[model samples]
Structure formats: structure tokens, C-alpha cells
Target: EGLEELSKHCFDYAVIDEVHHAQAPSYRKVLARLNASFVLGLTATPERTDGVDAVALFDDILAWQATIGDGINEGSLVPFHYVGLKDDVDFQQIPWRNGHFDIAVLEQRVENSARMAKLWMAWRMHFGSRTIVFCCSQRHALFTRNWLRDRGVKAAAVFAGTGSDPRGESLRALVSGKLDAICAVDLFNEGVDLPDVDRVVMLRPTESKIVFLQQLGRGLRAAENKSRLIIIDFIGTPAIRTSDHSSPLIARRRMQ
Candidate 1:
């Protein structure tokens, strides 16, 4: 339907969101057929899942570039303290697909009571007033939310197809201090901004560098009364990589 609409008429400008997906075959097809005078692509991370630079489709020129570290130094973003916790679940034994882990297997592994207890303990150790816990799946997210609530913490889970009304209600509750934390699947990954979110919990391992950075950016948004953000990354062991590490600390003053 979108392709058909694009084929019908020409436009002055075409803007693509999450523009890194331009390398996808479907996107490539649409872009190739788009008859526009000017094209604009917006994406924080311009790399593709296949490890190809998607910027090639955009003339290979950066209009403007600013990293999270740069934003922090410029005082446009909040400072951060990062804590790395090793994942007890052995993801190496799980099946892998193209780029990411098999979702079904990952969901089962993360939902383990023992593993979730470790996650809960870590959160307790570095508890933040307002936090977002990024889980691997909706089931995992709902489970975490219920677990937190059962322990007297006011929490909620939000994801796509949750309907805008309830999602907005939960977000309002979080902002008003009625909620302690939100257990989210992929809804908070990008675009959504919660300036007052002072803490971010990564309950799932990163599948791509682009996604990892986007998730970290959720807590970097500057807000009044927020001195710094705390990042808790759950590090999972992969099957083939024994010593691989991805760090968000890029030339910034480390918070103690």
C-alpha cells in the first residue's frame, strides 16, 4: 500500500525514521521507487544488522554528528554511572539466528526464577527512584512488573499493541511519582523520551551496537533535579565470544 502510494505521485521531501533500516530489501525497494525532490534520513545509528553501513544510501555524508559523550560534556545530556553485572544464564548454549539470539529460547532463559532473583538483587543494590527495566519479551516484562509489585514496588509493563490510552496512563503515573519503575519490552528503545528517568536497567543482552546505544540513550536525556543517570547492564556470555565487550564509556569523565 505504501509503495503504491509512493508510486502515484512525487513529493517535495521524503523523511525516513529509523533510517538505518534503509538497507533492508523492502526499504531499498521503496526508496528506489520514491520520486522526491529531497530525501532526509533520521537515525542515531546508521549501521545495519548485516554490518553494512546504511549511510551509503544517503550519499555517505553526515549532516551533523553528536555522540552521547559529547552531549554529556556539553551539558545537554545527563552524566552517568555505569555498573556491569554478569548474567548467570549461559546464553552460549542457546540457539542463534541471524544477528540476534533465538527469541523463544532467550525468553525461557530470562524467565528463570533463580536468574530473575539475581536481577532483582542487583536492582535492590543499585536502586533508583525512577527506573526502566528493558526485558527481552513481553512475557518477561510482565513477569518482572508483577514481581516488583508483589514486593510492594509500584510498577507497570508497556509495549506495542497495549493501546495508547493505557500506555499513556502508565507513563503519566511514572512521571507523577506514582510508579517506581516500568518494565518494558521494545517500546522504550527509541523515539520515546522520559526526561526524569534517572536509571536504566538492561535485562537483555544487546544484539547490535546500534540498539545498545539507543537503549542507553533513554536515560541520558537531561532533566531538572537529575544530577546523573545510573546504567545497569546485564552482561550475557555469547557462544563464540569469550572476551568481547561493548562499553558506553567513550572519553567521558567516569562517575564514581
Candidate 2:
């Protein structure tokens, strides 16, 4: 409805975020109706789930481009030590729908005592001073926080519904060394910066390469006394279930 109304007025340029979604039916329909003279699409990753190149929708013209590796080599982003610990949860057990797993069932499985124990073991094995744990749900994040706290690890969980950093405390606690980790569900994915986050724990399975990369950016920001970020990823057996992409371990194994 908003797009339809906006389509009536022509603009010189239309800037779109996460521009990779332009190929989707809704975006396509909206773009078709718009009468902009020029369009600017911005995205960190332009790959799509349907196997189509998103650049094609933007006229295939040359523009500014900066790859993650480029940023790492230039020293603007911290180089990372990625550790892929084997997770016991079978990927096939979760219901797959529309290119992603069912979140409800996946959360239940990931929140299991044994599963959480494995996750904690990996964190303990490679302990980073400050870490951000990406979880499947708010409950999963809270459970992880309490589980870690019980083991004497200072941790907290923050999400959208509760708003503004879960516990009504500043996330700056991570920088002060008061908090060891922050378990979150989409709160720190984007638009928020945590420069002191030296580690990232990917506990959720994601099909979108863009989202995976965005979550990773949470820990890549350069900071004092921080030379590298530690990425502890839980890799399940048989398959990792991401859309048309190899397991993150396979791609990041050379970093170690």
C-alpha cells in the first residue's frame, strides 16, 4: 500500500537497503511501478536464495564494491579465528520450509540440555573475553544466559520485545569486562555497533548469506587490544542446511 502510494510521485533516485531483495516478487512489483530516474541499491552481500544474481536487477553497471576479505587485509576490519565445533543436533530433524528451517522446532531442539552443554563446552574450550551469541529465539538466548551464569560465566540475553538491551543495563558491561557474553536474537544483527566484541557465537542456523555476514560484522569492528575476532560456529553433521552454500567451516577452515 505504501509503495503503491509512493509510486505516484517520481523521484530522481531511489535508495534501497538490503538491495538483494529486489528480485523478490514484492520488490519486483514495487520497482516495476516506480518511475524513478535512477536507482541506487546497497547491500553487503548481493547473492539471493533463488540462485539469481542481484546485480542484474541493478543494470549490471560497475559501482563501488568492497569485499569482506578486502576490509580484513586493509586492517579496517579485524581478522578472525573461526572455530567450527561439531554440534550433535541432526540437521534433517528440523522441518524445512521456504528455504529455511522452522524456527519453533529448531529452537526446541537447540535448547535441549545436551545441545546447550555442547555449545557451552565449545565456548569454554575457546574462551573469548567478550562474545556475542546469536540465538534462534528469545527463550534460547535467556536459557543460554542463565546456563552460562550458573557456570559462573557472566552473561545476559537481550531481544526486541523486551527492548533496549534485555536487562535494562548497558551493553557497555561487555567492554568493562563485567559481562563475558551477550546472548541475543536479532537485536545486534544490524544498525548497532559493538566495537569491543572480540568474539561471535553463531548458535542459529541461517540460510541468508547476507544475514550471516551481518551478524559476523558485530565482532569485526576494530578496537584497542583487539587484534582478531574469534568466531565459534556450531557445525552439525551430514549437512549445515544453509541455502546453496557450503558449511561455514569449509569456507573458513583455512583461516585457522
Point out where model 1 deviates above 4 Å.
Answer: 1-15, 25-37, 161-165, 239-256
Residue pairs that clash (backbone atoms under 3 angstroms), model 1: none
TM-score between candidate 2 and the true structure: 0.76
User: Tens-digit lDDT track for model 2 on 160-179?
Assistant: 77532544474878878889
Each model's lDDT comes to 0.77, 0.77
Give lDDT: candidate 2, residue 149.
89
Would you give me the overall lDDT of model 1? 0.77
lDDT by residue (tens digit), candidate 1, 44-96: 77766578887788678777776666778898788787776667888888898
